[model samples]
Target: MTQPSQSNNNRMVIKLVAIVIGMFGFGFALVPLYDVFCDITGINGKTNPYAATYDVNTDVDTSREITVEFITRNQSGMVWDFEARTKRITVHPGELNTVEFYVKNPTAKDIVGQAIPSVSPGTAALYLNKTECFCFEQQPLQAGEEALMPMQFYVDPQLPEDIKVFTLSYTLYDVTGTSSVAMNRG
Candidate 1:
């Protein structure tokens, strides 16, 4: 009887350990899984990181106007002043448009910053084609330096008829430390 009891306890312990390990594995997988899900459903406004090719022959749908609103933010610990020069613009579908953003380094030292962009009404991200954007590269600025960043994009004419407005937001982060480390390594 004692032998059987000990055997049962050992099995229970092993089962619990397996469950914990499985839970940890699931936790590690959640991020990539969520990204995949978002990519498929267009849930979190994940925009493509590559430049979009524009066809000059594409017809501009002048009748369909979309209101695009620009917003900006600095990540916590980032001290740079950043803003979109244009707050909002009305654009015709399939017609190219441009907007400029302003950034200044107020700190006394040079810093490298990177911008991450997202489009709200998330589904519209798929149709928002960017041909040129500052967000594509890390921006390095000297102290007291100011620069104008431009973004050129167009909305696909095939966008759903019910969607007439979308918001494009950029969050800038201070990546000076990592960038410096990489540069040193090189």
Candidate 2:
């Protein structure tokens, strides 16, 4: 009777350990799963890392106008002054436009940062394309240094007529500890 009771207890312990391990694995898997969900549905307006380039010969749609608003933010621990030079712009679809963002590092030490971009009116994210953007690469700024970053982009002519305005926002994150290589590359 004693041996049977010990065997049952051992089996219960093994089961609990397996359950804990499974839960731990599931937690790590959620990150990629969330990304996949956002990509497919465009729910979070996450932009693709790569810029898309269409043929130069493509025609612009001059009749429709799109109001693009730019917004900027600095993540916690990032001590930098950042803002869009132009708050908003009216542009025709398929017409390439450029805008500048100002960034200054006030801290005494050098810092490395990366800008992550997103579009609002999440459905419109698929139609907003970037040809050239500073967000594509990390930025490193020395103390007391300021820089003007440029972004070149266009809206697809096929964007639905119901959506007249869209916003593009960028959040700057300090990547010093996570990406030491980025600091060197910038």
What lDDT does the true structure give each of the candidates?
0.92, 0.90
lDDT of 2: 0.90
Candidate number of the best TM-score? 1
- Kindly provide the TM-score of model 2 when superposed on the true structure, using C-alpha atoms: 0.87
**Model 2 spans > 4 angstroms off:** 178-186
Per-model clash counts, in order, read 0, 0
Report how far residue 156 has shifted in candidate 2, in Å.
1.2
Give the number of colliding residue pairs in candidate 2.
0
| Candidate 1: C-alpha lDDT | 0.92
Q: Best by lDDT, which number?
A: 1
Model 2: per-residue Cα lDDT over 1-186, one tens digit each: 699999999999999999999999999999999988988887778777888896677689998999999999999889999999999999999998999999999989889889999899888898988989889988888878889999998898988999899999999999877765544434
lDDT of 1 by residue, 1-186 (tens): 699999999999999999999999999999999999999899789788989989999999988889999999999999999999999999999998999999999989888999999999999999999999998888888878889999999999998998899999999999998874232211
